[model samples]
Each structure stands twice: as C-alpha cells, then as structure tokens.
Target: MAYLTLFLTAFAAATLLPAYSEVMLGAMVTQDYSLWWLWFWATAGNTLGSVVNGVIGRQVDRFKEKRWFPVTEEQLEKARNRFNRYGQWSLLLGWMPLGGDALTLIGGVMRVPWLNFVVLVAIGKGVRYGFVLWLVLNTAGVPSESVPSP
Candidate 1:
C-alpha cells in the first residue's frame, strides 16, 4: 500500500505537476519499507512520467494548432537546436527541480536517440533516489544491516 502511494506520487512528480516525491520517499524510508523495492518503484514511476513528456513533445505539433499551449514553429525549432547541442549535459542535470520535464520534452523534439535518453534519464533519477535512500536509511533509526550501503 505504501509502495503504491510512493510510486504514484513519484510518477506524478516527474510530470509537469508540482508534486515532489522526495517527501513521500523520506516518509517511506522512515517507516522502514524495503529500500530496494522503494527505489525500484520510484525510479520506474519517475522514468515513465518522463517518457510521457517525450510523447508530448513528439505530439506538440498537434497542440500547436490550439491556443491552449501555443508554441510557434520558430520557437520550437530554436528549442530543438539548443537541445541538440546541449542535450547530453542537460540529461545529467535533469534531476534538478526546475526544467526537468522541459528537458525531457526537448530531447524528444530534438530526436535524441531513445536508448541514450533512457540511459541518461535513468542515471539522473537513480542518483536522486539513491541520495534520498541514503538520507532515509541513515536517519530512520533502522539498523545498518538492513540498509544498503551507499
């Protein structure tokens, strides 16, 4: 049950939504949930959310005709060029609070290789979850034997 909540929260947070999964992750860690399971579910959820961002980017042209999310073709082209030039570095920083979703979308729009995007996104998100796992494991009063070493 707790794992489900954590997964959903993490997934939503990865999207353009403003929710933060770290809070739930912290709480779960404090509760002594299995660290491995928690990390796996959180990573999976977050990655799926990021994939949604890519899908949206691919379909952005459809939305361009609508005023709801207006993006000029010129602007889109500029964003694509910028992403093409800087995408590798950008992937390294996608775990940051802002622009993560935009970065994923831009990568898709710029036609970055899917495998590379997945690898980079997984690394970024894994690092974030790994950090949170460390914090929770250390602070939750769980015995060291139960927690995986960083």
Candidate 2:
C-alpha cells in the first residue's frame, strides 16, 4: 500500500498537474521503507505519466481549432522552435521541475521515436529518484544498509 501510494504520487507529479512526490519519498525514507522498491515504483510511475503526456502531445494538434485549445499558435511555435533546437537530447532534462513536462510533450510533438522516449525518460526519472533516496537517507542518518532493499 505504501509503495502504491508512492507510485500514484509520482505518476501525478510527472503530469502537468501539480504534485510533489519528492516530499512523499523523503517522508517515506524517514520511515525506513525499502529503498529499492520506493525508487522502482516512483521511477516507473513517473515515466509512465510522461509517456501519457507524450501521447497527448501527439494528438495536441487535433485540438488546435477548438475554442478551448490551451496552447496559442505563437506559444506552440515557440515551443516547437525550442524543441527543434534542442533535439531529442532535451529529453535527458525531462526530470526537471519547470519545463520538464513540456520537454516530454514536445518530444511527442516532434515525433521522437517511442522507444527512445521511454529510455531517456526512464533514465532521467530513475536518476532523480535515486538522488532523492540518497539525500533523504543521508540527511536522516539512516544508513543505506539499515533499510532493507526488497
């Protein structure tokens, strides 16, 4: 149940919706949950959420003519220009806070190969979760071995 909650939180956090999975991860770390399991579930959930965003990005153009379209033509153009300049490598920074979600979405807009998208997103998000786990463990003086790996 704890891991499921972590997975759900991480998934939501990866979307455009506002969520703070790091806070939950840190709190869970303090409680001595299995580090490996936490990292695995969080990474998996976050990556899946980003993939969903990418899928939505692929279909975003269909909604361009809608009265409620969220992105303006100019805004879309700017995003497209920035993404083209960066290329698929920008997916490495998809784990960042501000423009991270946008980066993932743009990858889809630009037709980045799906396998490449998954690999890059998974690597980025996995590293982020690992760092958060390490930070929490050290800050709490909880030896990595003190917690089970599971």
Candidate 3:
C-alpha cells in the first residue's frame, strides 16, 4: 500500500503535471518504508511518465505546420539543433527543474531513440530517488519513533 502510494505519487510527479515526489519519498523513508521498494517503484513510475512525454513529443512534428500548433518552426529548429549538439547526455538532466522537463519534452519533440530515452530517463530519476533515500538514511541516523508507523 505504501509502495502503491509512492508509485502513483512518483508517476504523477514525472508528468507535466505539477508534483513533488522527492518530498513524499523522503517522508516515506523517514516513516520506515523499504528503501529498495520505494526506489524501484518511484523510478518505474517516473520513467513511465517520461515515456508518456516522449510519445507525446513524437507526435509534435506532424502538427507543427498548423498555426494552432504551440511550437514555432524556429523553436522546433532550435530544439533539434540543440539535441543534435548534446546527444543523449542531455537526457541526464531530466531530473532537474524547468530544464529537466523541457529536456524530456524536447527529447520527444526531437524523436529520440526509444531505448536511449528510457535508459537515460531512468538513470536520472533513479539517481534522484537514491539520493533522497540516502539523505534520509545517513542524516545522523534519524530516530524511527519520530517517523510515524506505517
């Protein structure tokens, strides 16, 4: 049940939807959820969300000719050039703010290889969750009682 909650939380957070899984994850860890489970579920959920983003982005080029399309031709061109410049390394930033989401979306817009997208996005989100769990576990050994029972 706790893992389910974290899964949904992580999934939604990964989307363009506004969310903050890190806080929820940290709180859960302090509350004594399994570190391994939380990390696995969160990473899985977040990566799935990014895949949604990438799939949505893949369709963008088809609609680009329409004036109603949100992205301008110039903008698309710039994004393509940037992706070309950075290669898959740019995907590592998917865990970051503003730029991170944009990177994910742009990856879709640029039609990044599916495998590359998954591998990189997973790594980025995994690192984020791992760090959060590490911080909780290593922070002077937090008292378990302070964290409410699960």
Candidate 4:
C-alpha cells in the first residue's frame, strides 16, 4: 500500500499537477521501507506520467497549424531540428523541477522517438529518486526501530 501511494504521488508530481513526490519518498525513507522498492516505484511512476505528457503533446500537434496554436510551425520546426540533432539530451531535463514537464510535452510535439523517451525519462527519474533517497538517508539518519507511545 505504501509503495502504491508512493507510485501515485510520483506519477502525479510528474504531471502538471503541483505535487511533491520527493517529500513523500524522503519521509518514507525516514521510516523503515525498502529503499530499492521505493526508488523503483517512484521512478517508474514518474516516467509513466511523462509518457502521458508525451501523448498529450502528440495530440496537441494534431491541432491544425492555426495562428491560435500555442507554438508557430516555424518554432516547432526548429524544435524538431534541434531534437533530431540532440536526440535524448533534452529528455534528460524532463525530470527537472519547473520546466521538466514542459520538456516532455514538447518532446512529443517535436515527435521524439518513444523508446528514447522511455529510456531517458527512466534514467532521469531514477537519478532524481536516488538523490532524494540519499538526502533522506543522510539527513534523517537511520530509521528508528520503534516510535515511543504517547
């Protein structure tokens, strides 16, 4: 159940929603949970959320190249060219704090390859979770064996 909650929190955080999945993971680490499972579920869930962002981006592209569309065709063209040259680099930023979600969505608009998306997202999210776990462990110290009763 805790794993599922962590997965959901991470997933929601990856989306446009304002969430702090890292805090949840950090708190869990202060408890006695298995670090490996927590990191895996968090990374997996966050990457899956970014996948949804990519799909939304693909759908956004279907909008006829109207003046009202958020990005001009020329701009999108430039992005596509850049993505072709950079391949998986931009995706590594997709796990960042503010701009990360937008990066994943743009990756889809630019028609980045799906396999590349998954792999880069996974790597980025894994690194992020690892960092969060490290911070929690370092700051929170080892988990206490028991909580004193009130």
Which candidate has the top score in TM-score?
2
- Can you write out model 2's per-residue Cα lDDT over 22-134, one digit (the tens) per residue? 99998888575777898999999999999988998899888978989989988998999999997898998999998899999989888899999999999999999999988
**Stretches of candidate 1 above 4 Å error?**
138-150
**2 versus 4: better lDDT goes to:** 2
In candidate 1, what are the lDDT values of residues 1-150, reduced to their tens digit?
888888888889988887789988877664557778889888878987887787777778668777677678788888877787875668766677788888888877766677887788888998999898887767777677655432
Model 3 per-residue lDDT tens digits across residues 1-150: 888888888888878788888888887776656677889999998888888888888888789899899889998889889888998789988988677777888899887889999999999999988888778767848785654442
lDDT of each: 0.79, 0.90, 0.83, 0.83
> Candidate 3: lDDT over CA atoms?
0.83
If scored against the real structure, what TM-score would every candidate get?
0.84, 0.92, 0.88, 0.83
TM-score for candidate 3, residues paired by index = 0.88
Ranking by TM-score: 2, 3, 1, 4
Q: Number of clashes in model 4?
A: 0
Off by over 4 Å in 2: 143-145
What are the per-model numbers of colliding residue pairs?
0, 0, 0, 0
Candidate 3 off by > 4 Å = 144-150
Q: Write the per-residue lDDT of candidate 4 for residues 14-97, one digit (tens) a residue.
A: 998878899888777756577788899999999999999999988876784666887777877776776668666889988899
Q: List the residue pairs that clash in candidate 4.
A: none
Model 3 clash pairs? none
